[model samples]
Target: MSSEKSKYIVSAEWVERQLGAPGFRVVDASWYLPAQNRNGAAEYSAGHVPGAVFFDQDVVTDRTSPLPHTVPSPEFFAAEVGKLGISESDTIVVYDGPGIFSAPRAWWLFRLMGAKNVYVMDGGLDGWKREGRPLQTDLPEPAPADFHANFNPYAVTSFEEMRGIVTTGSRQIADARSAGRFTAKEAEPRAGLRSGHMPGARNLPVGLLSTDGRFKDLASLKQAIEDAGIDLSRPVVTSCGSGVTAAIITLALHSLGHEDNTLYDGSWAEWGGRTDTPVVTGEA
Candidate 1:
């Protein structure tokens, strides 16, 4: 296996070579939209990379929160990760069913919980499966590990910080929702939520940053961000329907070496559902 500094994104070929390396943990962080009606854990059980553990986003998150997939407390995260046999020192490669969707969320989650060697598999299981990579139907029985937790607040954004950004426009807000959703032309998939975006936010639609679930190269990522009118030199906060796909933007920013980006934990779920928070719609 490659060192941490050289391997933030492992291709299918590389992952195949390091299938059972020591200190390596593969996690299937697959999550889906409610409308899709897909069960990530069920799919994971049916087939997954050998020795891969299922990281259930809903079950592992802040259960007390009304919002979806809120980042849990560091203690909570550590406890859950420990059950999955992951530790701070492990080289974790997280992947979802799709290429780069929910996997980045898992990557971000580990990073926030102080895992220095976390990574997102570029093509994910889909890529692995497409390349005819080996998979196992029977789950591996891993001994539970003790994961030490350290919280990094800089990787997360609070509602208060989001509100401040809305007023000051100091930090550039990048919305990962589709252009229609960003413009309020289409109804939200969730009920009782406003259709639009946070005020002063730019619509970057995370899908545009990747092709077939894998992220675009650095040059394309730069173009995409610039096309969205985001000033990369300034601070950036990424948001999506909830907070899942926002991590795609976070991943892209990190790939570009923009380390100042933060992911809005509440995202549009908390913002749009609140009657008091400001909302604006229409093409940018």
Candidate 2:
């Protein structure tokens, strides 16, 4: 693995330089867990990177599903991104307050919609604030653009497909939840959900992939995956509490040049809630 930084992530200073440049878009994809007690939208309203548009995780989701923040249809996603004045060709940079957390979901969404030139802002908005970069409270007057979304279903895995993987072990399953939650030693943040991992799943907590709100170098990221007993040569399915942090694993795997990977959108929120799903209560 190499220490290439340009493929998957960009620094705060680099984002500042591209602020007013043409065909470049900055998106604030901040989202918080319920326990964090913080409102991502409210924080974005207070202040964000200049010319940055807010991408609400809750709003940019499939409302038809009972699960929280499910991925929306390609048509709906295109309309919402178009309203944000983002064209498919533009360079999109996504960031959250905490680096490599919720922002990758937006990055993943852009890729799933067949939009390229997307990168996650390393160190996130917290690094921007620490560097004393310009922050604006006033919203930009967005001019709607033609964002034709071409969705690729291969980037995501359905529940039925995931169930098949669990039974057959055809692909590697990576759980991005904390060690305690993954091992069923601690309770889940969501109520009424079982605390354990899928059968034959590998535990790769999000912490190992990043540090101090920034992702590690490529070699380190690869080593972390290898230490978790995952083979990059095999296919992978990443899952988290509700499919948000799952992208962190997907991002790391993609950064490592492993393209045969898909995210489990239903994640544990759907898996643990059902009584029919077989969940193991210890390490894989």
Candidate 3:
């Protein structure tokens, strides 16, 4: 069992204490499903934590990709972070509406872009508000900072990489979609998408890694992951509906001290949509 003290998660209390620290940046990385009918940027403009900047998921992605929120090039990422007043040296604390959901995607993005001092705020804004932390409606206008990016390609899985994994069996493919979706018992929320899991993949829903939007302790996290049949000793490639929630799995893997992992940015949106990719139904 792992100790909570060694976990990567930061409590709202610790974040409150670190408010206004030099070189510290808080980011509101809230994202919503199309069905939710909520605009993330609009919500951030209305009320957000003090000194927190908005990290627009859609805008910071690969604009040319047909898939949703695919990872952007290092040059593109550096430019976007520069506009947000974020630099490689800054300690970035990212949060979302729920606990650890969308924040991990942003944390993963920063890490991919060469930012080492990045973290996700546990329980996110929901926990912060439940604890009566202060919030501000006034939008901050921060001057752009110089951001240097060193792209790490190892952290991302290309379609070719996934194709190789399908046959080699060298890496564990973990799908973060619900069991119903993974088993093809339920239709995908997005229209025109196929319903099924990747062949030879293990289903580990992202919600299992969190409790009411907050991440569970390290011990519980490890147990949940291993129980899903994922071997932490081997490499892992995380995937989800559209590669968004997959980062939740990546974050959980990191918290458990598993370093060899990558995120399938196209995720099910690409794999399930295509006719050539092999799909499987039923539990792994």
Candidate 4:
């Protein structure tokens, strides 16, 4: 793995030591699909890493948007994270129940909002528990801190820009949905949406980038991207069912030093649900 990628990830052991360290903050950014039968908040109340706060993915979003967990405005993100006692300069480590799943979304959000020292906890909370690391049931009352927003607009791709990309092929589209969903072989989890994918979009299922909840090694990640027909040398826009798991692709790409990439905020939640966008069945 590239040493550069290490900047984006920390081990559970490191997090355990940083529990009460100055300017160090840990966040549990767990969210699961309805089919997974997991409740992030409830589970958090039951047990979480000591000194870690819960990041409600569902609640901390752009409420005005009809789509799920749309990236909130910079001001909104600043305010929400500030309420969580997260300052832009603090060292932040985010993790979820599964090793490398929803945590990257929070990591990407912090970085996109201009936090410089954000990282995902490798092996997630699951691995932490397996190792008999510390856990606490009591919720923390973090003192609110000011989080200045330095949002990077370029890190995000809107529906209009995505349309132009699909039409002009300006950037490669990497869909992180499963092969079944990308090929329309299986039904989408959300209703009133098309089953296939956008034209020119390559299937790069988020699961391929990781194994047993932990991300794959650097060589494996590169192979997975190439196996999905994605060119690391070119710009990429990562997408998924709603835009959550897509960040895994973003995390993997950024780890490999592929910086010319953006996350499609609307993802399939907006694309497939709309009639105007073109949808195609089968593989890329």
Score every model by TM-score. 0.96, 0.98, 0.97, 0.97
User: Which candidate tops lDDT?
Assistant: 2
lDDT of the candidates, in the order given: 0.88, 0.92, 0.88, 0.92
**Model 4: per-residue lDDT, tens digit, 1-284?**
54224458788998998889999999999999898999899989999999999999898899999999999999999898899999999999999999888999999999999999999998988899999998999999999999999999999999999999999999999999999999999999999999999999999988888777777778888888999999999999999999899999999998888999999999999999999999999878
lDDT of 1 at 127: 85
lDDT of 2 by residue, 34-97 (tens): 8888888998999999999999999999999989888899999999999999988899999999
Which model, 2 or 4, shows the larger TM-score?
2
User: Cα lDDT of model 4 overall?
Assistant: 0.92
Candidate achieving higher lDDT, 1 or 4: 4
Model 3, runs deviating above 4 Å = 2-6
RMSD of each: 2.9, 0.9, 1.2, 1.3
lDDT string for model 1 (1-284, tens) is: 12222236778787778789998999999999977787789989989999999999998888899999899988899998899999999999999988788999999899888899988887888888898999999988888999998898888889998899899997999999999999999999989999998878999988898789777777888888999999989899999989999998888888778899899999988999999999998986
Query: Lowest summed lDDT over 10 consecutive residues: which window, candidate 3?
Result: 1-10
Poorest 10 consecutive residues by lDDT, candidate 1? 1-10
TM-score of 1: 0.96
Ordered list by lDDT, greatest first:
2, 4, 3, 1
Q: What tens digits encode model 3's per-residue C-alpha lDDT throughout 113-176?
A: 8999898898888788888999988888878998999889999998989988987887999999
Candidate 3 vs candidate 4: the lDDT winner is 4
